[model samples]
Target: MRLTRPMLALTGAVAVLALSACGAGGDDEAKAPETATGSLEQLAAKAKCDPNMQTDADEIRQAICTTGKDKYILATFATDRGQAEWLSGAKDYGGYYLVGRKWVAVGQEKTVTALQGKLGGTMEEGSEHMNPGGSHNKGGHHS
Candidate 1:
């Protein structure tokens, strides 16, 4: 087999295209949107969290919010692993929760849980900085 430069370049291009088509290498079910329909701002409103939008180096959209005393962060990642990595790092600081692939919340457990309910996702507990996971019917009213 003659491995010419042109052939190598062609191969590389094809490989790149194939990888791009795969789209983050995850199940479609896992990547479902956390909300029914709305912008991040709308979701924040529904969740009763102030939206301080920011993106991390990985391009994850972080929406930080606070209810005077309590604060939290929400973001969406492309893959479960990405979300896990974010949660792992974020758990150290304080309350962090994953609301599917489309949302993450970090702050007081009650606040995060409230957001989780509003956003429609699961709560990932087991961090020292976070209290036990459960939806709080009180507090977390965002102004």
Candidate 2:
């Protein structure tokens, strides 16, 4: 079989188109939202909670939300770097974190997990910092 240059180009184009079509099919579900895309209140609404505004600043906005009996902190950052920095510092406290782009929800493991159902995010577990010294007994040393 003899293949001409034009025939080769056409074949390459067809292959590219086929691959693109395959990728497009499940893109909606396959790709997570690039960003949470809402204010603290809006996000809280999505999780079925009315946020009690805790901190409203230019760089970040935070609020306390209670869905059912579970209470969680919902925070959104103006910049990705700010969110990452905040997460890094907060993780030292050791708790459950639901992280989405430019936003995070912090609370108990169950609470965070439940929030994940309504808000799409990845779960992160913070490491607990241990006390260096033994427990200080306020009762004083026994004789």
Candidate 3:
């Protein structure tokens, strides 16, 4: 059988379409599964907590949640920058933070770890602020 120009063009077009379709599907598969992001109440509900409203401000909405005697503060931010700034400042105090998309849950290490299992966030730790005299004090002052 002799090759023809029309048949070659059709074959090339079909190949292009098949490649394009494969590329599209590959992109979808390559991407990670989207994590759910929600408000303070919605997230607390997911984590099975009765959120006590702490601060309901324009920049952030915060709630104190107690899960089985483990207390934690869950906060959702209006802007990513605000959340980052808050986290930065809070880190100096030394605690465990379960961080998500524009949201953070502050608590003890064990509590935050447990929350992360339910909330799906990365664990962050603040500085322990230890003094040279084997003391975990803020200003390291012993009078």
Q: Pick the lDDT winner.
A: 3
Sorted on TM-score, highest at the top, how do the candidates line up? 3, 2, 1
- Locate the minimum summed-lDDT window of 10 residues in model 2: 19-28
Give per-model TM-scores. 0.50, 0.65, 0.66
lDDT of 3 by residue, 1-143 (tens): 43233432233233222322121111111222234489888899987888888567777777777666666778888888877877776665556677899898776566666666676778777655511222244466654
Looking at candidate 1, the ten consecutive residues that score lowest on lDDT are 19-28
Q: Write the per-residue lDDT of candidate 2 for residues 73-118, one digit (tens) a residue.
A: 7888888987887776666545667899888887666566666767
**Among these predicted structures, which one has the highest TM-score?**
3
Better of 1 and 3 by lDDT: 3
Shift of residue 44 alpha carbon in model 3, Å = 0.3
RMSD of each: 16.8, 22.1, 24.1
Candidate-wise lDDT, in order: 0.48, 0.61, 0.62
Runs of candidate 1 with Cα error greater than 4 angstroms are: 1-39, 56-58, 67-70, 92-98, 129-143
RMSD value for candidate 1: 16.8
